[model samples]
Target chain A: MSETNPPIKIELVSDPMYLCGARELVSCIAHRIGFDDMECSKIALAVDEAMCNVIRHGYERATDKPIWVTITPLSESDESFGGIEIVIEDEAKQIEPTAIKGRELEDIRPGGLGVHIIREVMDSVVFEKRETVGMRLTMQKRADRPEEAPRISSRSSCPIPAERRVS
Target chain B: MRERPIAARAGGFPLSNDNFIDIEHPESGVCVVIPRHDVDMSRSPILRSAIKDEMGSGLSKMIVDLGDVQYMDSSGLATLVEAMRGAKNANVSLYLASMNAKVRAIFEIAKLDAFFSIVDSRDEALSA
Candidate 1:
């Protein structure tokens, strides 16, 4: 992630076909941010999973719904950490930010692992509503990221929605 | 992924889209399923259907040869997880072979690395 370059914003429909191209974009961006192939692929997969959630649950698989993804690079001077940040905005019906989650690994089932993947790959994940409608997902990864990212199950440990935020 | 013998052309046949899956049985009672291209959300359904169809057909053991896949997302993982459950019930042994570092990491992140029987090469999978 770099501050010198402008952030990349992507707008597309909820259709799943476009996700492959989106993943390639994020992986390339992560590569430019100095991450290795493994990390880059993880970042791309995480973003892909997030988009799948928006398309699956938020949009109910409606191919025509809109989803916006903004990827901003962070500099080392900002917080003594340099990495990548991605914000996903969905125009689907807004739900309680806390309600967004995946199934527990302990249960061992399919269909709810996307949320787990996003939290496990990224450094920090925050959710805030887009004022009146839709939801915004803000996920950031630090350059000195964890070799093993933390799992999220306790909702209390998560950051709450800010009084004011952007989509 | 190490270079290993792929029954790529031996008794190969497509299940759904001809490009998605190539089924081959190199030896008796062993079936190898090779999923082509990146196994993302869009491609996952095809892979899932192919696996489901194979499981429905009686087989002693199955190996999902993933040497050709460069990438896989949660949807791909979900498809395999579902296959795992189906395999367990059907008493059909399953093994995942030839995953590159990148695809294997996706499994590790989901904490499923411990659950599946994964091998490094296709020959190992076939002989196991």
Candidate 2:
């Protein structure tokens, strides 16, 4: 929330093996933020998918490339509701943010469900291609606490915008 | 990096001493795989390759035991879907057994719970 309370940051190679560590880190953060078991698991899963996309699509499985993750706790004023924000940064070939789409569920197959899963679990997903190189993916989820209900944004109520949704 | 038999392809890439997965042949034509870690992008490849090898060997009935798997992401789900496709092509019956609560939730969220044959235990899966 402030400079003194910096977000948790983790840097790892683009290798898939680090994905497990990433998942564990996010899961711990989600639990510390008061998310329930189910919510924590979903958050962890969403974060994992986002990282996978960066490693596989953005970095093209180049294990030497670096991937950075930052998890910040958000206050109510940051958005209509208070929750957590996960930022994934990768220095790889830039991809069009709008072009990212997951495969249709009806067409059952492998390798395309990452985007869809992230979209489903998170309250909002935003993609931005960095100026010179790399891409940044930000996924936010509203805390499901009763006290946070009144300030919840109408936008946050919808998990994913239909336009950007894959499934 | 090291070459190992399908039996040793557990845990994930780089194959740690932790044994992330285990394989068993309960009966002829039946193979059971138990994953001991979270099935994400890092571990899905191991699962895919193992199932592919089983399909190649003409195994007709495959059961995946997810009782020990506490987490699974889309990549893991995609691996299962790919395995399903391979099984269909080989005329093999692929079943999922003992999915924990967290793993089951993901399948339900993706609406894949209806797509796969899910059972409470390996015995039920084998019987199904």
Separate clash counts for every candidate: 1, 2
Best candidate (score: DockQ): 1
Tens-digit lDDT track of model 2 for A55-163: 7788788888898999887765544446788999989888788998877888866667778888889998999998788999988887776564223232333232122
Instruction: Give me the runs in candidate 2 sitting further than 4 Å from their true place.
Output: A1-4, A77-81, A147-167, B1-12, B56-58
- Per-prediction DockQ comes to 0.75, 0.63
Error of 1 at A144 (Å): 1.4
DockQ of candidate 2 relative to the true structure: 0.63
For each candidate in turn, the interface RMSD (Å) is 0.7, 1.1
Give me the overall lDDT of model 1: 0.79
Each candidate structure's TM-score, on Cα atoms with residue i matched to residue i, is: 0.84, 0.84
Model 1's number of clashes is 1
